[model samples]
Target: MTLFGGLAGVAGAAAAVRGTSSRRISPYDLLLMTAGTHKLARLMSKDAITSPLRMPFTRYRETGGPGEVMEDVRSEGSLRHAIGELVSCPFCLAVWAATAFSIGFLFAPRFTRVAASALTAIAGADYLQLLYAQLQQSAEGTS
Candidate 1:
């Protein structure tokens, strides 16, 4: 089978499993889920330090500034490889993260918010740190 077919099968299976699970996903929760997915996905798939974890499964491509582009994965013609691709892709992993968040939000709203808050807060902090460095560099260049 083609790689795209395998990827589709993995995603489909995940969705089917999620569908079978009991949960309530409201419009507002969907918004929170989207936000959470964005934050968590960034950390998991794009962070510089996460390279080691994905290195075995992915190949380093061009630099993505703080992170790097990963390719040549997910096509090893095996389920393990497909999972690796899923784990290495922010957009792909976001769906899984969002699904987990949906279940967590439904079953453990308090815990879910606390964890999401931590990650969201860290994401905010990361931007602020980058901004601070940029401003510092500008000042240094000006002087």
Candidate 2:
């Protein structure tokens, strides 16, 4: 809870310091950010490629999904365990990812949009790939 509070405090401070105002975000940008946040959170938390970053705090368990992996949080210490849990849970990481992109949008909207668009595209591609694989499997089974 302290960590979450700290994040909220930092975001609030940044908004005050930067004079950020209440501008309504467009639906397109909102969707892009949502998809981008989902992909970014999953990539950071479960993607096999990013395991090295989480290795210190988590132990590799098994393959999770297509390119994702399951990991157990290390119970070495409070901070480390907390970090491990945060990095291992996509639901938890989503908060951080959304916060980061929100901050990025505040600081540099253009760059944030580009990055978010790329992540959103990747997320779309991932779904398509899964659908394709499922169709192929069905076709093979029916043959």
Candidate 3:
């Protein structure tokens, strides 16, 4: 959950930065991105997660005149894939919608206003992106 929350924060920051650089993103774009991200996440699973070999660990040692010493450490663990099977799952979408609603309602006037505004912007951006994609497709078809 924390991981997802952190990612959401990054997404929010990205949206803010993008808005400053150019026209505010449309809600459509936000929807598309969210969909895409959810899809990608679903494709990932726990079994897919893996840890890097040659565990890099720093060790401190007492040195008479030098700085410090390092020791080698080895551990065995299973790879945990962050992406779950939520991409194709409708449950993921339901959870997202529910979570958003919960947050909006719980936060109400305090944070809801900002959250709603952000969501609207995202939805607009998403719509624009979708429209652009469709336009591109149509153009290609005519050619």
lDDT of 2 by residue, 19-119 (tens): 87454567888898999999999999999999999999999999999999999999999999999999999999999888888877777788989999999
Off by over 4 Å in 1: 1-32, 67-75
| Candidate 2 or 1, higher TM-score | 2
TM-score of every candidate relative to the true structure = 0.67, 0.92, 0.33
TM-score, model 2 to reference: 0.92
**lDDT value for candidate 1?**
0.71
Candidate order by decreasing lDDT: 2, 1, 3
Quote the lDDT for 116 in model 3. Answer: 46
Among the numbered candidates, top lDDT falls to 2
* Residue pairs whose backbone atoms clash in candidate 1: none
* Candidate 3, position 136, lDDT: 100
